[model samples]
Target: MTARALSARSLLRWLSLLALAAGCHVAPIAAQELIAHPSAEIATLTRNEARLYFTLRLKTWPNGRLAKVFVLPDNHPIHQRFTNEILGLYPYQLRRVWDRQIFSGTGQAPITVDDEQEMIQRVATTPGAIGYAAVPNEHPDLRVLQVR
Candidate 1:
């Protein structure tokens, strides 16, 4: 092959490899869903309202019940997905909001569960409780909240 032809082929091969590498690192869109106790009076929330609940800014349900919030640890994959995909916020931003609330003595952080199982159990048993998980419908005791 001519030297020019060889160089062009090499460049094409490098570009193909680079594109594959970039595609491998791209994150898949998460499928996390917001869940609540089966008895929770609220069925749907605006995205802003859901954000407020997770941030500890909104304290009560529309039915006048205290809104109990549960969460997985900050570093858990499901928690990260929930914060990023559902709430449209990073985990650190949520932590900062909670920390400020605690330091200011005006609010408290959500109850942190160990894993998805515990998250489901807590939300199912705790009245007015809300949380997020993958496939929340699998548990009949938990209600999936629609975020509009």
Candidate 2:
């Protein structure tokens, strides 16, 4: 490679690295403060806890009342990620499990809702219920559970 060409490439590489570092440094400060906000104080859940909570595998709350769950549509990316991250299963696998439960007549799968507002409304009205959303809706009756 020619000397001038090599020097130009090196300068570009250094500039890219510096820009990346600056971006990395700036991004976390905003995220950290947002996460620390008072209303966002819901507890972080373990993978198992999140799974059981959402799947209704934990049929009842610690208080013994039957637990209900609400979920977003299967096609949604966030729902897919939530299922994979919490249950260690894809949406199809989770749906199959629910299908089996329906066939067995032992228990029902959690209800799936169209959007966060509907989910929040359902969970708020239903006793021992849980659901998730990007930003929680303003509902006096609903409780938002935090998952780390």
Candidate 3:
């Protein structure tokens, strides 16, 4: 091959590598901005607290208030992702797990709503309420609890 062609190819490779490295560096901040959900000042929760809140185990906050929880529809993508990735259970398996839990009558599950907006609105309107929603949809009305 000619020297000019080889030099052009090397330059292209270097540019591609630089772009990739830059992207890698910028990715985390972008992801945080995208995924991070902020809550109202009074609605803040620690990671462990958030987990307990979501599981229907903690019926009340540490402050002696009832902990109401709003959840997404069964078929929501976020619900699927959360159950599979975070809870380590698939939909069918999750059903079985819930069934077992229900049979024992340990506690009630979070109230499932149709969409993020509905969950957010319900949580906002209801006292001592918490809910799941996409970070983008999070608003001043609803508070997001951090999941440990």
For all the candidates, what are their Cα RMSDs to the real structure?
11.7, 11.1, 11.6
Better of 1 and 2 by lDDT: 1
Which has the higher lDDT value, candidate number 2 or candidate number 3? 2
Residue-wise C-alpha lDDT for candidate 2, range 24-137, written one tens digit per residue: 532221111101112322345565766766555666555566666678889986577566544556799778777887889976797889975676667666766666655524
Please provide TM-scores, in order, for all candidate models, with all chains considered together.
Answer: 0.78, 0.61, 0.58
Candidate order, lDDT descending? 1, 2, 3
For model 1, the run of ten residues with the poorest summed lDDT: 24-33
lDDT against true structure, model 2: 0.60
For each candidate, the alpha-carbon lDDT, in order, equals 0.83, 0.60, 0.56
Clashing pairs in 2: none
lDDT score for candidate 1 against the true structure: 0.83
- Scored by Cα lDDT, where does model 3 land? 0.56
Compared to the true structure, candidate 3 yields what TM-score? 0.58
Best by TM-score: 1
lDDT accuracy of residue 36 in candidate 2: 14
Model 2, runs deviating above 4 Å: 1-44, 136-138
**Worst ten in a row by lDDT for model 3:** 28-37
